[model samples]
Target: MPEEKQQTPPGSETEMNVKPDHGEQSYVGHGRLQGKATLITGADSGIGRAVALAFAREGADVLISYLNEHEDARETERLVREAGRKAVLVAGDLADPAHCRSLVDQAVQAFGKLDVVVNNAAFQMSHESIEDIPDEEWNRTFAVNISAMFHICKAAVKHMKPGGSIINTSSVNSDKPSPQLLAYATTKGAIANFSAGLAQSLAEKGIRVNSVAPGPIWTPLIPATLPPEKVATFGQETPMKRPGQPAELAPVYVLLASDEASYISGARYAVTGGTPIL
Candidate 1:
């Protein structure tokens, strides 16, 4: 990690110093998600991009929901198409409830049905004190991180049939809070709880719901939110002594989305580089 790396909010992968590996060259699929219709928020970069790539190769048509990173989103769309799958790009703010619902509708419209939903988009900022956090920033974090997931699921479940899967992106912060990321960490905790409760409620409908809690991964979000000094030493605290790549987290998401995990739900899968979630 470089000491002088930083970026504006909602960062771009094209602008990264050392690009994160999205399993572009290494991932080989066997049609695990064959003919599935999927929608993924934040698919423009980071874990979202990696998941989109994996799903595409696994035979799923993807609807990519991103913020404003057109270049990054286009790159992801290219990867999906390259894998011989359909990819639709939809750019908007996930903080809006209306936009969240619209994303599911668009995916259903594009593929004629929706089978999987990955609520992975999130916003975070570093603050030394609670007083330094803005009321709007706090509200915005919850809106994009957890509220959007709820709204999207509400709309998607109607279109999804049995065997559908909903995967939410929780964080290591959900279990191990980071003081500087107070607002972001708070919402992550809420996401874990929300996923748990939602999973139980959706069980009767045969819709599996689960959450993935990722530790420090080498993504644009690192430089975008943390200071340069902190970014340089990012992931040092992990037992692996390095940050996990986006590609490393992809297989977990792929498994959850596939029918192989039909009996698994209401669980939190942690990709924390040996850091325990509990």
Candidate 2:
């Protein structure tokens, strides 16, 4: 596989070495999320987009949030609409606290209520040395990865009722920190802790909070954030020796969002192909 390192930060899916597989044709929903309303960040592509498709197929209306991937976001909306569910697209930088709050408000305004929130948007970059990482880059990573989740969750909990669910996107890096991904790995650890603590705190409200720790998945974020050399061999180090597709994660997300997970909270679910998170 060949990869062209992206010149811009947070690379676009359209310019990827290999565009991610979002399960447009394969994912089948079993009405697990019937009549539910969901808000998913990063729903323009990758795991978030796949989750939106599955949720809609399972009979949930989705409100998608993305930075500025209008074309990709529109395709996600089309998939949701094709499933006979409502799709609302909101574009902005979630790194901003006000924008994070606005996403919650938009979801509430569009759906009237929120049943599920998937904080799946994130930012990452690879650097050889700490000296190579800038102060603003470190802050931006935290702001988009963990702080945005905190801000959005704070605003979203108010509109959610009993049996609502919140799923945060963590990473296998949390268990095995990658020195090259210091900032991203750190934020993932925080996300896991946040989910566990919030789950306990929200027990009275009956809102289940959990995190999904994924290994190397073939998403646009990979090529965009990594050096060209690393991108070409991405995920080859994993036991599976291949990156898991975005569609492969949709089922786990669907299960977490469904009421069937009523008793499953405060847990970190690892979807790292052949890697063990513990």
**How many steric overlaps are in each model, in order?**
0, 0
Candidate 2 residue lDDT tens string, 20-138? 88888888888999999999999999999999999999999999999998888998999999999999999999889999999999988998999999999999999889999999999
Task: Report the number of the highest-TM-score candidate.
Answer: 1
Q: What residue runs in model 1 are displaced by over 4 Å at the alpha carbon?
A: none
lDDT assessment of candidate 2: 0.92
TM-scores, one per candidate:
0.99, 0.98
Clashing pairs in 1: none
Candidate with top lDDT is 1
lDDT of each: 0.94, 0.92
What would you estimate as the lDDT of candidate 1?
Answer: 0.94
The Cα RMSD in angstroms, rounded to one decimal, for candidate 2 relative to the true structure is: 1.1
lDDT for 156 in candidate 1 is: 91
